[model samples]
Target: MKGDVIFGKKGKLSPMFIGPFEILEKIGTLAYRVALPPMLAGVRNVFHISMMRKYTSNLSNVLNYEPLQLTPNMSYEERPTEILGRQEKKLRNKVIQIVKVKWLNHLEEEATWKTDKDMRTRYSALFDKY
Candidate 1:
């Protein structure tokens, strides 16, 4: 089941270990571990990707070269770096604001609450509930 009809099998095998995207993603991970040098690792990764491309030709849900689509809001062919850069710029500010807001909330909560409940609980009603 490793290669394909390119080898000894005349017909397709039933429940063949071909793929679901999880296996293809796993191939990416395995490709990373292949005994290649860093530069060759990139090339080998592309090769394994092309191998995936051949089999996934018919499925609509199967993206050609993509492992996991990071954005559902944006399409892959849209050159997402520009979108990412803008989003990241916005996110940086938002995160800073969130941190400040959280700091203020923590201060407010500390002022409001004299004491917080402890986690440990004694179960006197265990058999009573049973």
Candidate 2:
């Protein structure tokens, strides 16, 4: 549809969808031109149908989305929000400590396991509470 919203990109540790941009016009049988915000001026406005997914609006599914301050390269850094849990992986020689990390702009179920040592060295403040 012309006014439908769609998923932009599947970025790592970022929101699955970006905007509810209006469809400007249909380019061909398989492509459509999108009305993109000024912040995404550098991005290509036309997209194929296969790359888009219709966004369904639900009051309960609404989220408070904070726009990221992207660098010149159209990228932003992802930071850890908290340490959820910890576990140890035993290898043949040594044991590796891993921590479940919840990152900003992500849900609890999306949390990932990362090396405790590397996370501590990079983001030591997250470990202060524990």
Candidate 3:
């Protein structure tokens, strides 16, 4: 289907599917030619059918899709938005501090636990309020 929406990988974020891009044409029996945006000029327009998933539109499943600014290498920087919680893990010899990190464009539930030292070094602002 030419006008049907399909899932395309964008970056290292949860709900990794980036677009419901227009399907230009079928490449062969198992491939498709997608119409990617100008920002994704460096990306190949063709994709195998296995790599794509049909996007079923739903009113309750709204996604806030923002266009990502990719560098020449097709990579983008992901930033931390907030520190959700903190905990200390006790080892045999010592205790290590870890923080729950909420990243930009990700939901709170998707936040990950990272070492406090690492989070402080990369996202010091998250600790400013505490």
Candidate with best TM-score: 2
Give the distance in Å from residue 6's predicted Cα in candidate 3 to where it truly belongs.
16
TM-score of predicted model 3?
A: 0.54
Model 3 lDDT, full chain set:
0.83
Order the numbered candidates by TM-score, best leading: 2, 3, 1
C-alpha positional error of residue 20 in candidate 1 after TM-score superposition, expressed in Å: 2.7
In model 1, residue pairs whose N, Cα or C atoms come closer than 3 Å (at least 3 residues apart or on different chains), thus clashing, are none
- Candidate 3, residues 26-62, lDDT tens digits: the string is 9779999999989778778999999899899989887
lDDT for each residue of candidate 1 in 1-130, tens digit (9 for 90 to 100)? 4444422344556333333333323444424222434333333322254354234455567544425445685534311111001111145345221111112212333322111111012222321322
User: What TM-score, over all chains together, does every model reach?
Assistant: 0.15, 0.55, 0.54
- Per residue, candidate 2 scores C-alpha lDDT tens digits across 1-130 of 3433323433354455567889999997999999998878877999999878898888987778878878899988899999999999999999999999999878899999999999999999988988
| Residue 111 miss distance in model 1 (angstroms) | 78
- Mark the regions of model 1 whose C-alpha exceeds 4 Å error after superposition: 1-8, 11-17, 24-47, 54-130
- Pairs in steric clash, model 2: none
Cα TM-score of candidate 2: 0.55
Output the lDDT of residue 51, model 1: 51
Residue 88 displacement (Å), model 1: 76
Q: Per-model C-alpha lDDT, please? A: 0.29, 0.86, 0.83
The lDDT ranking, best first, is 2, 3, 1
In model 3, which regions exceed 4 Å deviation? 1-62
